[model samples]
Target: MKRISTLIAVATLALAGSSFAADRPVHLRGEVTAVGAGDFVVTDRKGTKTTIKLPEQAQVLDVSRSSQAAIQENSYLGIAAAPAPQGKVRAMGVMVFPEAARGLNEGHFPWDLGDRGTMTNATVAKVVKKASATELEMRFGGKAQQVVLDKDTVYGQFVPGKRELIVVGAKVLVIGASAADGATAANAVMVGRDGFLPPI
Candidate 1:
């Protein structure tokens, strides 16, 4: 009887310990009304208002950091002081992918393209015509097509078999990163030529 009693006590204590640990809380991403010095009061995904403490600037990940410091530095939004275990993210801006955006996004829309997002392979079939160095008049499907750039003002001119055909018989797959606002062309930002971007 005493041995059984002791086992019960041990199991009871274990259960109590688990319950106590559960008392600890976690923060979820939500809408922010404003920003302040060290802490920001945000409406959590659950629709509850919670205050989160911001780390020092040095802890933030400047996503904008790129070959062109002046141009890319501005794009960074800052990541967590310490990266999450496995494939998790603690802060914002590190930009791993749908995983990083999962919790924090809460239901938010896309922020911008090329900021650690996915890409699609779109082929440039033929140049229906030429608009300029910045834009393209290509046919992707059986119909006429026109592609333009808002930032670089220069379309990628791929080499052809015998001519600078601009877009004829050229099959260059493009990685269409998430647009700034939506999934459609209405939100895509014109990021420069494709290259190796550093990891977060």
Candidate 2:
């Protein structure tokens, strides 16, 4: 049994693109993009991404994705890639909302995505600040939505257009029981937990 690197790829979401559980050491020869329930995505050196399903019934050996393993790996080399979901057309629709998705969300992790539900085409806005460095907040319509992040804290990286401010501008679907259309919300009322998978 070989081993795979256990790394969480997404931000704070439970079933978006993070670790669910580890049953066996399913090894592949590329950087892992996303880790899910018995599955993971890998991109070769040619910018070609393949999502490999982990073995459940039988053993997976010399685990590589190709018509023929060696030929595919050899042709594509030196390509930078990351792991994403395999066969997931959209991020949170089926992967995080169905049985297979449900099986994944229960994996060993601290993900608390409480089915707070979906928000689509939500406007991205930032909180107004008077200081150079301050906590970031988003204003959607008349409501303000506090930015919840995995880092969870910031010392001084709140410039607009940067990573800090950009996340607030990114579209999202807040996962919790009381799901709302984040696009029409009025103010910064707490909608769900910090657990979210940015739809970007």
Question: What do the candidate models score in CA lDDT, each in turn?
Answer: 0.24, 0.23
Against the correct fold, how does model 2 do in TM-score? 0.18
TM for every model, in the order presented, reads 0.20, 0.18
lDDT string, candidate 1, 1-200, tens digits: 32333222221111212322423222133344444554444453356654444433101111122321111211211121122234322222222221122222112122222343221111233322235322222222234223332232211211111112112222211111122332211000111123212121
In terms of lDDT, model 2 sits at: 0.23
Judged by whole-model lDDT over C-alpha atoms, candidate 1 comes out at 0.24
Off-target runs (Cα >4 Å) in candidate 1 are: 1-27, 61-200
